[model samples]
Target: VSQWLKMKGKDPSIVPLLHPPSKEKENVSQLTLEPIYSSFNDWATQFFEEKANGYLACKLCPPSSRTVYGPKTNPSNRSSHVIDKHNLEPPPYLRNRKRVREVKKQKQQTLAETPIFATTEREKQRENIVIVYATNLLSASTLDDPLWRATFGEKLAGMYPQLLKEMTIEYSKNLDKVFFSRAFGPCCLMADGGKDISKHKLLGSCIKANGKIHVHELFNTENEVLDTTWYQKYFSRVITDIESRSNLVVVGITTDNEKSVVAGLKKVVKTNDHLIRIACGPHTMELFLDDLAKNYKPLSEAIKQARNFCVYVRNHKQPLSALKKYQVDVNGNPVKNPLTLVLSNNTRKWSGGFLMISRILRLRSECERLLRNFPDVPRLSWSSLEDARDYLFEFYLQEQILQRDSSNLIHYAFCWRQMGRHKDSIVESLKATNHDTNVLAISQCFVKHQEKMEACRVFDLCCLLWPVPPKTNNHSYFVNATAQLHYLVLRQWKFYQDHADALQLPEEYRGTNENLRLTFLNKAKGQLTMHYEAVELEWRDPQHLFQASQEITEGHLRQTLQPTPNLSVPGISVEDYWRSVACLCPELRFVVRILLACSASEACVERIFSDEGNIHDKIHNRLDPAYSESQVKIKGNFLVERERKLREKDFGFEELEWEEE
Candidate 1:
């Protein structure tokens, strides 16, 4: 710019003298924080690497004919490259030699054995025929070692087309028969629903409880009928084929909060049994976010405007010109987004793509009366407004208090208590935002809550529901200590009400009615509610419940043993169990594991997910080549080490021998 000034008839020396080269005439313009990069090539290269640009990349690929191959070789019946490149692959008959090799081996074996054992050729034939007819026809294929290389093999079979074509078709037809049978096989194959981690999409019935969380299978109602509902009606028949398993009825389900599965299941469970439903913790968290905007109206407006500021400023001249002239400050870090995406000005740290946008909104607001011009923007999340308000109101207090507490127990106790609302806020916000950051934050914030809640529920539910022999005695605290307690209390009450006449009944029934239990529960609850309320648990953290409950009096079994891990399985390490379960239940494992691992009982699962938000859709393609995930239904974390172990294992379980776990 200084050299240009010298060439253009102005004093070039003036450029160095000015602290900044550009400023508005009114002296009211915002200072440009962006640093100018010396290398446009490096800048542009780094700029396009972010995942957000991925969608746009697909649009840039207009079709072309592979840039045209080469001079047309003498036109031949077979592709020249196949003939030239893959001669060793054999013609169709020879390729099928492996298929027929077993028969040839049998014939060869019979000839050898027949000469030694038979008196005559005809006698040898009868002996061989007798053994051969009884022998099982077999080729080496297995459930564990299914041949998937056929996909690549078919592509390689182009050589000797006339000789191989018919054989290739026969091979394919045989493979197809195997494939169709597998796909149509008993749907004992239950893949995760891609959203809900709480409920498996099978004949899962609610375990009776008063405040039991309703775990419901999620399904896409708009496009196709889901397995959840299909199994609901036909599960009885399906189970008959396997074993007759019973179903349980409860208040509702805990799912990702979609109405489709919830609604369908409600219809299936409908009867005089009395059932309704609700969304799971993650889904409910979503509700809170949208509600945030409606309640904290300002934050909603701010986020919407923040979003619009990015869109609006790129079209407006003032901001666009300023951005073009401005250099990004962080090593000219090749702007995290396209110039069009970041055209608006903002003064905040601008750490996030969204926050950067929000800052732009702020910058635009300062320049123009944006708030007054637009009262409501469509699709602006409500939680953004509520989150801003909570940060200023509630979270601010939490941050200050949490920072000052030096003693861990007191600090943790207070932090645990103080953090409940914030976690709730984050979970709600994340659910609303569908933003992994918010989800992760929620997981981290109130992980204790989930730990406590799930632990209490799991123990209570399993003990009460497990088809085990009833013990001579059980304690109130033991049953109630579990997550299932409150709901179990309710179910016990309902069971009495339905069967027991309140005033005049089987004397046995009257003793166990809701009125009788409520009276005792109200008194018991009165003694503890204040202390329990001292720190409400975080939903993301399931382990915290056990920890928090540890402060309470011990149960009979617990008095002798350490508190059981809140996780569903008992024989495995909590961490290891959850690590594997996360594959089967990624979202739930994400929430539960974070809670278990943290001292404060708030694992940052939501935060971690937020950090990984860009890869949510990319996870399948980005597999670590371990875990043998390709062509399989579920995949997980531990990718690199898993691949290393898989290669070492030589693609089979137990090193050439089969063993049951």
Candidate 2:
């Protein structure tokens, strides 16, 4: 006890008093102990019962347990033992003691400091309100409206007009800090141009990083000529800026296949050998739909008549009322919500045309009844409308699938393959019906765009990487794919070798000796062949045993398959499949990352342009370019972060076999 007191920085001389000498204890008789015993008796009685033998037993413990205290024992000692051994609270009378009160006061103070009950900080609440306004495309002046003040009070109402702009600027700076802190990998650039409601020509650019698309920039291009030369210089400047700012490697550029844009990308590709130019898949499909509407005489006439009928129904109330009445029965009960005639927007792609045709077809019977009373209404061509709807329906579905931000080269190739099958079926049916002209037109249109899409060598390489076998029976296609894969692997390997010291290449990857280099190259080739065979086998009959031409054993395949149990399963995405198999295919993993990261469509940029239109509408026409850009950045990045967190929550984190250097 003396040593413990000394170690605790206390006076050791006081230790002897803790266990008083017997002479001092004897001096304290029953008369002196009586007062102390009497004072604790009341408090102790609540938890302990006194027996006839002058011993106290605890009531809380089990009856069989040996817990008894003698009468001569100090009441303080008995109380301390009971409280410490059983983890019990002090008696009610002891609650007012000074020490207990001090402890309770300390606890109250700590609870007061916790943030659980605290309100949001004023500045944070302000920023959140600004984000909500920007994301919903609300006018900045709405912040100061009377309704806002009544709902949120004066402090949070943001009465100042410039508050939105100021808050957006601050948020954008924070986003820049976050973006610059991460190590960038291979990414693609998507750029497009559009006009706002006020006729302000705007160009938007976005970058796909780590499979998430982020808006990079949006600015007015009214001052500059949007020619091929201008576009080339603009792309060069953008690429240089992106590379200078981060480690992102621009592997490809995707844009709509407008004449100027295509010519500009071609020039950019010629100068930058590493970059590939891709035509937007959704845009190409849209053009095909437009062709059907324009070139086919019967379809064109039906669309014209359908559009005229919609305009008439919307303008004249009598026919509209009649249509609504037809929507109900004699009892005037509505089975469903009354759907009005929908007008097609020239700007939007397949949706407008498809919706217009479908609505007209659904209301065909009602319209035929109304025509007897209203002769001015256009005559119905039910057969022509049905054909147009059927043709446009396929492209509409394709457009919806291709416009997804997650859609990569693999999805592009797969969707087009499905479209080709659809076209073939349509052609066969048309042949049976003796509609030779329609058959020829559909075949030629599909082949023309498909050939253009396949012109980019990256598509073929991605298709090869895809687990499913290519749709073609041609052996030459696979041969070319193998050759291209070899070239890509060798190129990546040489790059690693060149930067071996900087990359801190692992022993397996660093081919320092000539023989080591040759061996690695041979192994890469063998692995590629084995992968191709495995893919074919899985596609044809998953249960079939795969036999590699080289020394690869069943154990090796098992090891590769162990990590990716779903690799052979349908509905797995290309990005997921490549990531799962990355560790087993080290050399090809680098190529996969670079090639798969290249987007086949500029749909992301087009969507951003649509958002821009909403932001720059007539009500918010005076929004400055910087303010608009900041709003777009905040809205885009905010949504991306939200979606990422949701994905992580829904399907835990995906294990990546290799991370980019």
For model 1, the stretches where C-alpha displacement exceeds 4 angstroms are: 1-192, 195-252, 272-278, 294-297, 305-490, 498-661
Cα-based TM-score, every candidate: 0.29, 0.45
Query: What TM-score does candidate 1 get on C-alpha atoms?
Result: 0.29
In model 2, the runs with Cα more than 4 Å from the true position are 1-174, 293-295, 311-351, 366-377, 390-415, 431-441, 452-661
Model 2 lDDT on a 0 to 1 scale: 0.51
What is the C-alpha lDDT profile of model 1 across 273-377, one tens digit per residue? 322222232223224334444444354455555556555555666555554434344576544444443334222211122343333433432324333443432
Q: What TM-score quantifies how close candidate 2 is to the native fold? A: 0.45
Model 2 residue 568 CA deviation in Å: 32
Q: Per-residue lDDT tens digits of candidate 2, residues 1-661?
A: 5677889999988755565557545532222211122334455566788887899888877999957889888777666666788776664556457377689999867654433212447445544443222111111111222222222333432343222223334545655456545626555676766444445566766555432344456557878888999888989988997888887667668787789988987888778755666666556656666675555566566667777777777778888777777776568686365655334232144435555667766777777888888898767778878876665444534343323322233344445555665776766655665332466776778777765544332333333443222233332222222223323432344444554454344577675433444444445444543444334324323122111111233244344433332334444443434433342365344333332333202232233224342211211112222234444453345444544554465342342321110
RMSD of 1: 27.7
- Number of the top TM-score candidate: 2
